[model samples]
Target: MDDAGIYTRESEYLDCYVQLGLASDRVLAVSFPEESDDEDADHALLDRIDAYLEGEREEFDDVAVALTVPTDQREVLETTREVPYGEQVSVERLTRMTPGLDASSDEDHDAVRTALAANPAPLVIPDHRVRDGPSGAPPEIEQRLRALEGL
Candidate 1:
């Protein structure tokens, strides 16, 4: 695993983890291999993170992206579009899980929870597609939630 340094001014950081012989170009262009238990592996990782967070074993403020392999392909692929692996949930929904807050409150804990549960794992999107949108929550939030839930 390699730390890609913080793009803090842009509110982002890149971390790359390499798997043996996993072609970066192919992995980005296609879905995970059908025969590989990648989904289960991903879930297990999420579970571990959740447990660590819930047990207060670690501290985090928002979710961070996980790149399986390091590459210079930060730009979006023009030919290959990404299809989300799971249900699409809006950022609004995730923020609903935070307690003691109204729907309009920006820092509601329920809203944070909603975001965490809705998108439990890091998502893969084209580099060009990534943008600094309206939601300014830091990447550490995901870590905080996992510790809160002790998943």
Candidate 2:
């Protein structure tokens, strides 16, 4: 996580992992598809994550993320970030919520799906809360996250 925010890459090892910026002492990147060790980096965000895993409700809205996708895709991820914890919204609904998207259009639906798949941060963006399309997370991971939210 840099001064601006955390940047993430999808992985296939653990639930989450982060790369630290040596000079800034901030996280440079976070990976959601898999797990990695960040045992030495003590941050409040990590604490919050721990809390989330233990069944405490954590909105994660306060966390900042740096998106490197195109404007259209970025908008989709930004909207996805606002999805409330414990609630799920279908891709159609999510597409509708995003500005300039026409849910009735198949192309729009595809855009939403593409945006979701391109999401760099899954848990932080709460992609799991969006259903009926790719969540930028593994299927099992998505199920686990939803179950944790009691959804």
**lDDT winner:** 2
Q: Count the backbone clashes (under 3 Å) in each candidate.
A: 29, 6
lDDT of 2 by residue, 35-151 (tens): 443343455666666677678899878776667789999899989988999999999999999999999989998999999988766778888888677877667777888888877
Clashing pairs in 2: 1-27, 1-28, 13-34, 13-35, 14-34, 14-35
Q: Which 10 consecutive positions of candidate 2 have the poorest summed lDDT? A: 19-28
TM-score for each predicted model, relative to the true structure: 0.21, 0.79
| lDDT of the candidates, in the order given | 0.27, 0.72
Whole-model alpha-carbon lDDT for candidate 2: 0.72
**Deviation of model 2 at 104, angstroms:** 0.4
Return the lDDT, model 1, position 58.
30
